[model samples]
Target chain A: MTYRIDNLQYANWSEKIFRQMREGGVDAVHVTISYHENFRETVLNFEQWNRWFEQFPDLIFHGQWGSDVRKARETGRTAIFFGFQNPSPIEDDIDLVEILHKLGARFMQLTYNNQSLLATGCYEADDSGITRMGKQVIKEMNRVGLVIDMSHSADRSTIEAAEISERPITITHANLHSWQPALRNKRDDVVRAVTENGGMMGFSMYPHHLKDKSNCTVESFCEMIARAAETFGAEHFGLGSDLCQDQPDSIVEWMRVGRWSKEIDYGEGSAAAPGFPPQPDWFKDNRDFGNIENGLRKIGFSESETAGIMGNNWLRFYDENFGPQQI
Target chain B: MTYRIDNLQYANWSEKIFRQMREGGVDAVHVTISYHENFRETVLNFEQWNRWFEQFPDLIFHGQWGSDVRKARETGRTAIFFGFQNPSPIEDDIDLVEILHKLGARFMQLTYNNQSLLATGCYEADDSGITRMGKQVIKEMNRVGLVIDMSHSADRSTIEAAEISERPITITHANLHSWQPALRNKRDDVVRAVTENGGMMGFSMYPHHLKDKSNCTVESFCEMIARAAETFGAEHFGLGSDLCQDQPDSIVEWMRVGRWSKEIDYGEGSAAAPGFPPQPDWFKDNRDFGNIENGLRKIGFSESETAGIMGNNWLRFYDENFGPQQI
Candidate 1:
């Protein structure tokens, strides 16, 4: 065994997509359950997922541990893991870190696209790193095994989070800015800071983070991963497709505006194309994991290294980080 | 051994009160953490209690089960159990019944002193009984072991709750309306419906529920209990106190008019006296449990019966009702 894991996705979930995950042999996917919802609203989302798990028990199950990936393989089902793309689920309460973790949230980004109570987002001009509550929440998250995700955070905040977290944090879905020059993508220094602290970088398949938007080739994407592997070791890379499949353009507005702004914040998109950008043809949905795997092998990566990039690295990271830290 | 459990209290909690509980040999207390707060505000209240438990570990600890009373006795500390006087902490979501229970809420009233989403309160003009959501919430509460408390609900609602709930519900702090006709007290049919269905009724120490307000005698109170024992068995009764010790009048206003009213709603108090009523001399604080014990004995009760009313009855109830139902 090697495992196929897409560590990030916010799809318009349906039976069709769940079937696609099974067809793709995707063992586990870290699905974003909340973007800007508050605690009660996020719980409603969990309740909705609970209904989904009940309705489609044979197709999918709620994943909590790394072993669940192996269990999913044996059972012939896809394991869906929960995460938050924003810290809004916790509001201002530090104790909710433990509460939400107990409710099966494994990953939470400190910010989304603006200044949050915890940390500054990449879109903010002044990145104040982490706030006072941020440090306390990080300690609590470390204690409770809620993995810190700085995927949408500023460079300073992302760097500080890697330094502050006792457990290895993650940038769950983004590419290198050195490759695409997108604001959402991490710079070389930011990626190095995270990987140096034993964290993982998940290559995103979202068009905005690609080399040439939706026109980017699999060759270019694989080459970027090859460069990252040479710079930061192969064990620190995995796929976090950020696959927002089948979601409407209005959903993108909710993700970007989200009750915080009265004006539109066309994050990564211009005024004309102000919606979720189209995915590159090579990587469109869950079934495209094979294309990326073959591309990695074609880019001069050995079998073991390709296995690590495909999913085993995330499985190892999950085994080590998704529980209370040993004293 | 007999346990000294006060099943209801909403005090201005401090080291002084905790020490007083120890002086009275009290083992456990189900403290009201929220009166009318929504889910988030209620969590803030729990956080405050968390701080208190941290600051005074030797004096108090968070209690979740009947066994914790024994643990408290062994450790020589008071085990503080959490409760909500209204269903506001759960908002309109039925799933929060389990969420709040996991956060250590042992009891929750269906209503306060006004009409709630679940049921009609005592002060309401008509008793419409339990709502459709109330039936679902009762089942959820039963499954999760969060006891339904109808101490502030109207007579019809109380009776309906007892009929609907699968597990034993509680009137955590109230008295018999037959003895003293107060709005907040339970009527004969209401008390009978609860106790006959294996529920517990905790006698209130609030002056408004007494025969002569603040001038009520211990002998009179004990005689009322003796009659109640004959009517509804000695095993179904215990002390709740309803002791709002050291709370200011402003706190009472918040309880009675928590974002629900524009004008003042004094609840049990009148316009002339809109604050917490004075406690009788016989039972002013936790240090006075001995007084009630003596009075019960003087009123022709046996030692075991006196112990049962003092706390043993509640401990037995806790043992049976504070865990997931046996399916």
Candidate 2:
């Protein structure tokens, strides 16, 4: 069975988003929950949790809390695994790791994209690896079932987290840094380590992170598939679009601030990527990548190769941690 | 028989604080819950919650949550509250007022020191009153049994929120902008509105906001307190020493960016005021004032006036909201 999972979740985890995900052809999703620093807006969708569980019985939800997401499970949703974006929330407490695991986080990324208490993000000018606390978090994440995902993590941190983790780690959703050259992308070294370590890699459908959005097309994404397959192997590649279909400006503003705790000029009234404007509303699946299935079709792969890319790879990865889903 | 509350929660609200409050002759405190966009940090004090419940078994914590806190009886933490800093977290959800009241919100401020969804903040260069959302939030806060607070709210929005609310409003923790003429202080018209609406004013101990942090002692803070009292009433005045103790550089960075979500330039590696290039910590309390209690003594008050300045005025304000202490 093909299992398409949406990887990153920041400002888009809401009731409004759940309905849209159904419309956009998402079968499963990896949800990240945290005591985020910016809690002025909605933090946990647990407010509407019952309604969501009742409405979408079949849709699988992989939750990333901290340690034991399985125990926090409500009957209807998918088994949630726990994870972390930053180790700051746990502060100085190591025992909280197990406590958080009990809360239902299955997969976690170490640093959010910069220097945190645990590890250095990919964007930092210096590639100082994981901090001592980061090492502890990794050791603890390993002790528990939380899988390591280095998506927006810095190179040094990712490699360090991968090296320290007992099981393999994942580049949950990202284009190669070699491909896009932005701080948001992962380096080739990370890609190599992931494949060698028997970890998984999920290519994201975020256009800005893809190499040259203006020149991007279905053919480009397919070429990426071939390149990633050759680099990461077919068994390790999956589809997890970091897509936000109906999210708005406030979300982008949250991203803009949450990207870094300090203030720096992010450019004029708003900032833009190479082919995208400062506005998230302006974002469209421009490269012929349609509703998840159409996106695979556009990539032009045979049935077997396509199936593995669509969901099989992620399923294998998730099964490694939480056991495979029962029909 | 005496009940007193200081309108500030920025002080860690720790066991040490409670001990200090009892020593400093304080009875209750109007603890500010939200000013920055950090919702996660505000509540769920997992480690210390029980201790707070045990100590002072009768203390009141007036938060900025937007409803009268009722869980006080269980926690011994009388949460006589209302939103003192309207962060617009109510967002578009006007119904959330009643919902949050059920969750224990009472007092609702129209805005913080800068702009929010509903109104411009006190520091903003331009003064536009209430936005449509601000009006709606004010109305809802009023309709749902929330008192209105206009501490750091913009002049225009403060007036509008005060004028619109069915109940008395508060300007909890402020200064006479006419005296110091600052971004953080309040304008005269907004002050008048608070008095007209049968509310209270809580003066702060922030230094850069005073007329010459050098030229003043507790003497300065009291002058501002007296000026506000003259304009309003002694009954409406209290102490809110927005006194932030143990607030490290991380929090200072948060406050700097909080002005407009963009950290405005203060100086070379300096952010002015709180971020003022490493001069000295506690410069606001000033060398002459010694500390909080000594500083109160410096204000040159009679015994009763000193008692009110210390915290008694806020205790009366708390009873006004949290149903005259259970005793």
Candidate 3:
């Protein structure tokens, strides 16, 4: 059965957003539960999401395993799989990898636009690559089925993480640097390495990662995916959409520079617009997922390939990777 | 002008211990503030210590710099320097290294009788050496004046840490494995490597690490120290004592196992004991430090050598190492 999954989103979650997820027929979504939150703060976020799930049972439910996507499909509700765009939730404890996994966190990035205990983020001047804790955490994450997401990690760290991870890791929300040359985007070598190792790359719809920013056409974006699929296997890519819908500019500040710096880090932005750039008109929210689906078909992906890009590939990946290794 | 400092201790901190330190003329002490606690929990431990400092300013005050040791001597109080037996206090965040230093953590063990994010403990069957995060943490610790203590770490990891650290690291407790051949003791090679790198070795009086356990003689202990001094420079050796005065057996469970294990870890202890063994009759408490002093003198040490071994050497080390590198 076909399933539509947005591999990443950090919306100002509300009943309205939950309804929009249902409206979008989004069977599953990997939601960013923590940006800079530590273990306790992130647990608080989880508790908040718990309340949302209870209040909006008809529209959403917690997704612990990949099979939950099917559960969401059967129940006509969206499955919310928890993820972290940064490793802050686990802090410095490698043991927390299993604990966070048990708490329903499925994906965690090693770094988020800075040097973390694990890896160098995309914004750091020097990319030290996977650190001592990073390597250990990667092992623990792999052991416990917490997919290593290198969305905002620096080039060398990201590549090293891909190589170091035992399981296929992911970039939950990012684009190809070859298409737009953005700092948050992955270069061809990184893309090649990730896909070569059976890892997934969820192309980002975040404006900063786009070529024309907020004005990027759906046609052009889909064309980029088509090209990416040609360069990297089509099976290894999906939509992450980094859709930070309805979040205030303050949240963006928290995202780009969470407690790490006193000065505001206008990452991938200038002083003129140090906030979330306006998302492209065709992809404003979860409800607009159809725009990319149709655009993918128009960009000449086979129907099966489009379905895979839309979500089936992710579902397959989840089926294979989102549980303790059988061995 | 000589000062007396116990380079490590995790006593059941109390007025009794403070008075005993005063009676014994201990100018300062490096106290273990955390074993398995996370940053927040460790902060709570710091808060507890803060309360102690507030309640007994005449007996003890928080020590941040080597100068504080001098201040303690002049003010007739024991300066309490904070340390962690395990890296759990920092959890997984590299940034916390600086934060912990600012909070007055002067010494941090890379590992404590098990594998940590930093290094392999002596208890582990295989020693992988200083980890990725361990290397980074060593550098950060060196930069921030947090001495890296590898007292409970495996041979390779301890040697690697000493080699990697830009500043001198330490083994704040534990005698020579050549003397006792215990799990927590350091080998001759490890000792050679540490002292060669200008690091200090604070000999432990913990019964489990002693040559004859609770029956070990002061003469034998000091003789071992003399041999260690001859082998690895008398200037690099001092007393840590590792005094756990007044602590209950339950506290031993917390020290050895913490939350990392569900079952009790009989680290350096057999199932027959599984607790803090009785102190040797000659060194039952802080007051017994004099016994060691006299013993060192009887072991054919020069007056200055004995004074240095008792504490002057550690004081000099503190002055040289307890700050950021002077560029």
Residue-by-residue lDDT tens digits, candidate 3, A75-165: 9999999999888887655678899999999999888776666777776655657754566678778888999898888888888888998
lDDT of 2 by residue, B1-327 (tens): 223455754654555655455454443455555554322333443224445656555654544331332233334454434343655434334555565565455556666554444565565555456654455566556556666777776676678777776667787777788878767677888778887766777766665556764355545556666666666666666766666655665665655444222224341134345453222233332121235445455655566765655556655555465321122
Candidate 3 deviant stretches above 4 angstroms: A65-77, A92-99, A114-144, A154-167, A270-273, B11-24, B43-79, B85-327
What lDDT would candidate 2 get against the real structure? 0.55
**TM-score for all predictions?**
0.53, 0.45, 0.70
Q: Write the per-residue lDDT of candidate 3 for residues B1-327, one digit (tens) a residue.
A: 767889888888788888999999999899998887888899999999989989988999998887888899889999989999988887766789899998888889988776665677787655657655566678778877888888888899899898898888899998988889887888899999899988899999999889889999999999899999998889999999999999999999777765544345677777998889999999888888889888988889998998898889998888898788776
Question: What TM-score results for chain B in every one of the models?
Answer: 0.99, 0.74, 0.98
The candidate, 2 or 3, that scores higher on DockQ is 3
Model no. 1, DockQ: 0.01
Model 3, residue B314: C-alpha shift (Å): 6.0
On a 0 to 100 scale, what is the lDDT of residue A153 in model 3? Answer: 84
Reference-based lDDT, each prediction: 0.89, 0.55, 0.86
For A218-283, candidate 2 gives per-residue lDDT tens digits of 555667777777776777877655664445755545444452222432421234531123212222
State in Å the error of residue A294, model 1: 0.6
True contacts kept of each: 0.00, 0.00, 0.02
Worst 10 residues of 1 chain A by lDDT: A256-265
